[model samples]
Target: MDSVKLGLKENWKQFALLVIVNGFVGGMVGMERSIFPQFAEVEFGVASKTAILAFITAFGISKAVANYYTGKLANKFGRRTLLLFGWLLAIPVPFMLIYAPSWTFVIIANILLGLSQGLTWSSTVVMKIDLVGEKDRGFAMGLNEFAGYFAVGIVAFITGYVANSYGITPYPFYIGVFLSIVGFLLTLFWVKDTRDFVKKEGKNNKTVELKNVFLETTFKNKTLSSVTQAGLINNLNDGMIWGLLPMVLFSLNFDNENIGIITAIYPAVWGIGQLFTGKMSDHYSKKGMLFWGMLMQGIAILFIPYSSEFAVLAGLSAILGLGTALVYPTFLATIAQATSPQQRAESIGTFRLWRDLGYAFGAIISGVTADIFGVEYAILTIASLTIMSSLIIKFRMPVNIKTVRK
Candidate 1:
């Protein structure tokens, strides 16, 4: 831990770059997420229920695909080049959504947005693990997720307010475009390659192999498998919360402002709570942190349908956030610890691909369920799925911590 801490402190420039690039990437995605549902409703006259699903489906599919390639690209070309390319792809995203002649254009933008997410955001997480090594990985991941989601929560609320005031959804898209351009430029001008970190450690001379990069080797380790599975479930719940919560509020007859306030609470709490949770991961077993986090998330989801008042719902949202905070960083730390340093990028990418697929699976399932039954029923179903996932982790998985060295 002391050596890891010293390395991070000495490489402050690299870590600062990670924080800024990842934070901006988060804000870019957050901007889209904040406004897309309203755009679907106001521009295409799509129902709130159906439109949100479009964004989720596009995001899930594109991110899933991009996760596979991002690792390979990072391995072949190096992380900085791939990251720069990803930021460039983001430049047109907001314009596509804002000037979209049909819902299909907005969907296309989301696909591109998802690509940016996988390439930039997912890669940044892997990069952090690269820089921080094993011992301080939890704290590093906590800071990473905290910056990203906190930007999302704040930007979502602000953009939601912008939409309500102007009654023009494109305004937010325009803002997203500008921010993404800034992020792109920042990466181009300021961010440096951490491949030097790997090179400095003399691992860069090894042959790059693609075989088994995406295979059972990933699942061969019990600890890695548990963390990966838990990550999938955690992201499954995240997809539900981000994909369906607004519609849940809409179904309850809340306006955009109220929806924004309610929607903001989950990520806000999740983001802020990481400060403590990240430190806790250092002192406790990663498995213990994850197990309790999943349990709390399940309990929070169960409480969602029962809360009729905004205050109670907000409280439940915070509880869910805390649960997410507990699990999110620990999961990343576990993945970093379980894999060899040389293969960390590919391993984390593979892990994220599975976790992100949970978003697609949860969205399609919950969307169809909501269409058939109602929002409350959809919430209940996701709650049940989450609880089942928690049980799987608690009972079936081994509780152990593994660490790899540089």
Candidate 2:
């Protein structure tokens, strides 16, 4: 334990490796993001919006369950074990996507993708937190999320372009095969468990461990629950974008390449903005970041429904991404600050359980609402819910504008 060092500079090599590994994780999601809805509508003849989005529901629910368990199981089985085991699930995904003759197989593939994401993404997150300790936690989260989401942005554009050039089936999905293999080999060969870092940090950590991690993270603690609800709302809106944005752009006559660029812009801005937002959290007020961030996202979502021009929509997406960037790292950093080292993993899992559920609820709600009320109404509904979430954070979470970080 005496040999353990706890700072980003000290763990740069491992941290860099984990960042690259997480990029692969986000790339997995990217492969499906920009084109799946189009694929369903075109290939499978599934025109019902709700039916097309069932894959996201499956992904959300499965990922939520896996996230909950990953936290409970992390310390017991070891992080590396959970990570390697997750890759096993990913190996079959691209093949499943490429060959599926029916919609059911696509749903099954997303289920696998969600589970693999839960385990692998959760492990990398926990491991990075374990590695960096206290000094640069927010920056570490920023870099971590940036790597993952930026990958999502990049892959989305590539696949969208590829799908535009070569008919959307075998070619775009080929990237998934390469990513899964590289991600797996990297984790198996180079990734190390962070249990030792946890042990080291725990020795000096004085924050009180929660009596019940789930209850407190979910509802009992005002500060934690505030952050938790904001996370759910963030992802909820994101799910809406994931499941519907392409369809909306198509309704306006934009092609796949354009839809891909518009879709990628939001996450690209989100990924890049976090590089600064994360560091800002360390120097500035987290509460302000959360409040304004959610507000910005809400405003952007509301505007999205009104935009018909390509540049206007793209600009709105960037604003939305920037808003999300403001809060994404802050959410994790706040969670880490509020909880003790002893139960951090479970607390994070509990928070993510509800957060990922937003994806399902968003997909289901938006899908059904779009089917019934129209796409505009569906967008309006999510945007309203997002604003309400921002208000919760503003009123419930305590203001901590003066806290300083080195």
Model 1 alpha-carbon miss at residue 219, Å: 3.8
lDDT of each: 0.76, 0.91
Models 1 onward score TM values of 0.92, 0.98
Evaluated at residue 195, the lDDT of candidate 2 is 91
- Tens-digit lDDT track for model 2 on 141-201? 9998999999999999999999999988999999999999999999999999999999898
Among the numbered candidates, top lDDT falls to: 2
Clashing pairs in 2: none
Name the runs in model 2 displaced over 4 angstroms. Answer: 401-406
Off by over 4 Å in 1: 1-6, 48-51, 201-213, 404-406
Question: Over the stretch 1-406, how does candidate 1's per-residue lDDT look in tens digits?
Answer: 2233325667778787888777788888678554556567778888846456767777888887787688766767878788888888888888887778998887888889888888998778777766765457788888888888887887788777887788656677777877788888888887766665654443423433334656732465666677777777787778878877876676688877777787888888888788678778878977788888988998999888877798988889889989999998887777666555566677778888888887887777778888888878888888887777777777766776644333
Prediction 2 global C-alpha lDDT: 0.91
The TM-score obtained by model 1 is 0.92
